[model samples]
Target: MTSRENCGYSSRTIFAAWVQGNFRIAAGCFWNTLDEFESAVDESYSCEAAETYKQAARDCVAELTVKLNKAGE
Candidate 1:
């Protein structure tokens, strides 16, 4: 929720793994890029929700909370 203060960050950012291991900035994994996430989203998955695995990519700088359109803009 808050920066460590010693991390030398001027902005607030929260990084979470949520039981995921593979992490990177520009990875093909779900968390990294939307294109990659959408492309790979066709695959069948069980147990966890799609949103759970659709979080930020591993080791990225920060995530954004933008206002999306109801009609997908």
Candidate 2:
């Protein structure tokens, strides 16, 4: 489960959270998914891979942050 295919579980969690109007839960799911990705990168790759995955994770968090903020409005 080290491949990108493993990402679907956490990705699905994010989608499920968002659909349920749970932005915080969605953000948490993103973090957990990113952590799993980072661990995988650390074991089989270099810092470059970790950094790239981190960037994508950060982008996801950023989007979730926006949604969360808007929900408060």
Candidate 3:
């Protein structure tokens, strides 16, 4: 069974919440980080990229948490 199913939450609900909270952060972080990486490499990177990376990391953590919780269930 999927983690959401194991935890008693429907996959839809889990995905919705995940999208609302974690996805946003993740997307943001990814873009931001990308920017940072680019800047580090080129020196003309956008600040937004760094933020995206940070958000992506945050989202990943949230996603992992949900997965772990489901596993525990």
Best by lDDT: 2
lDDT of 1 by residue, 14-47 (tens): 2322223322223222244344543453353332
Q: What ranges in model 3 sit over 4 Å off?
A: 1-46, 70-73
Give the candidates in order of lDDT, highest first.
2, 3, 1
As a TM-score, model 2 comes out at 0.41
For candidate 1, give the lDDT of residue 7.
14
Which residue segments of model 2 deviate by more than 4 Å?
A: 1-37, 70-73
**Model 1 alpha-carbon drift over 4 Å, by segment:** 1-25, 28-33, 57-73
> Top TM-score: which candidate number?
2
lDDT of each: 0.29, 0.43, 0.34
Judge candidate 2 at residue 9 and give its lDDT. 25
Listing every candidate in turn, what is its Cα RMSD in Å to the true structure after a full C-alpha superposition? 12.2, 8.0, 12.9
Candidate 3 Cα RMSD (Å): 12.9
